[model samples]
Target: MAATLFPDNPDFIKRPPFETDELRRCLTNYLDTPFEFDPSGARPLVGNYRWGVYAFFDYDDEPIYVGQTNEQLRTRIRRHLTNQRTDAVAMSVLDPFEVHDIEVWPLPQFQDVDPKKDRTAAMAARLHLDALERRITAQAITNSQFKAILNEKDPPPGELTVEVPPSTRGCIVSDRVREIRGHPDFRIARRALIMSRLAQVISERQVKGGLRRVMLTQAKRLEWLAARRFEATGGARTVPQEGDQDGEE
Candidate 1:
């Protein structure tokens, strides 16, 4: 009898590539990292943080999104990236594929603050979260070359100010995944697709001005990346036109 050409899985199901599995594992590992100050390792950063602000950074180390959640950080972030259920993901305001690094500032003091049980504490916790988010948002903008991140809406204005707390930052993408997705052309294509979808969303709905701002920022980022790639590849030497004449018109 001839040997089988390919071994069959016990469940008769195809498996994803090793890199794909590795990528997911990397993400989980990053999220599971013990909070920096937790010496006893009692809690993971994302899982234990009941109120927090998180930022997503793209391959170029540019802050692309900022968000605050009273919901468990793990639940909210997983929904955005893995589940693709958040409004930002659904509306294409953010592309999970572009996120390379994640930075989170967890508010552990508010971990037990329950809105229904203790309205005053909950309100104060919310204020702290808002202030932290605003600070992060400002930092993101200041660090950005374009002076803007891809957030569809600006962080809410508040006189309340808070110093940034201890934060945890990690790369969510595995090196294997980076090798496949790190090419500028790949990123440019992905950004263009997301931008197109965002534009479509704006056209279909009576969206706020903030959504349009996000589209503009996306366009700038796309253009900047494309230009870099083009120049790096030795930009078009000459135009192929009839008689080799410059088309001034």
Candidate 2:
């Protein structure tokens, strides 16, 4: 049957098949979420805080990376996810697509401390940030199903440690994005591709042992997801073709 051609409608807006824009909005909304500073709810956390620590979690709610920044958490996290400015992204140690949730600890106390002018105060604040990062990293490792995250290098061990502070956590993936990326098969394929790219990077350069460790962790994660999917599907049933002869060489 012949079909009639319709005139283009310029006034109609169409949504994209891919959810990139939706995901970006979800991330922005998550970052803009107000954190409860106290019982009175008078002070909400802002994104301009200078000293902060953050963590990224995957679709399965597994921690994938942890980092601290003396700069603004908003800037550092946006660079990691929206662009390749962060070393972790450049090295393929962290894939922004895999990040489904974020948790951040903002230390507003050091917002006014400038490293150039007050070196001592800045250094002290950095130590506290580092300590907080290390503690969070430990918790992530303990909570992870594989007992490891994708960070190429763990936060350096230190004698100093800080108490956990009030933090805000939120999902960054939109429902539309989840409809596609949240599928098990899609996730497995994406993880495998990232692992392959990371391996190729390692092979092409004189990389450190920490990078190698990341590769191993990726392998484990891939294997675990694959196995889980297989189990959930109860494996595929084998069938014989009617035209095929049994035991034919």
Candidate 3:
């Protein structure tokens, strides 16, 4: 009997991340091999199984979600099957024949004595999970589609107008800018601030090439801020503005 290519034996089933020719070949190779279970109750003898990435697909094979786990991949998928926190269950119900594909990637092996390496691997798992979630959200692919959907369902009403807060109105523009610039997610916040600032500058009849230069400089700074936020939160959160709670926009 031929041995499986995976770290674990043939009994350990994992779905490939995507359908590709290379992956099909790998699966064919795996299926051709005879089943073998490890007699030892120990870890894989050759490779690490500390991390894995998986994607949940609908009946049409459209990926609905992606995730990562550091524990046994089978156990993680089972939890998803039962858990209500994510859309996994609903998606499964919506398409009863939903297929889940998992791809296990071996992380750097760590001995029992090496806590630092283990911690690093754990952090990597968390980061991978975050990345998987972002990928599955399909933000880049779905944005235009969502907009079109919305357009078809409900046409645009009109331009959105947000009233400036009166309390903050008298506040010095420079001071307001400084406060926004100091935020941890400074870039987007700063850009919002600049937009507000530009409005203020225009209101004060102070538009100039110097102001444009300043805005561009702040735009670069805001770009850095946005990158940092993406690194921290995996994505940007829309800033809540005044009158937003009333469904103004």
lDDT top scorer? 1
Measured by TM-score, how close is model 1 to the native structure?
0.87
Give the range of the ten consecutive residues with the poorest summed lDDT in model 3.
164-173
Query: What lDDT does each candidate get?
Result: 0.85, 0.84, 0.37
The reply for model 1, stretches above 4 Å from the true place, is 1-23, 38-44, 238-249
Better of 1 and 2 by lDDT: 1
lDDT of 2 by residue, 81-152 (tens): 886787788878899999999999888677789888999999899789889999999999999988988888
Sorted by TM-score (best first), the order is 1, 2, 3
Give TM per candidate: 0.87, 0.86, 0.29
lDDT digits (tens) for residues 87-146 of candidate 3: 333322211112322223223222222334567656544554445434433432263222
Q: What is the C-alpha RMSD, rounded to one decimal, of candidate 1?
A: 4.6
Candidate with maximal TM-score: 1
The sequence of per-residue lDDT tens digits that candidate 1 reaches over residues 3-36 is: 2443464444465566556656777887788886
Q: Give the worst 10-residue stretch by lDDT in candidate 2.
A: 1-10
Name the lDDT of candidate 3: 0.37
Give me candidate 2's TM-score against the actual structure.
0.86
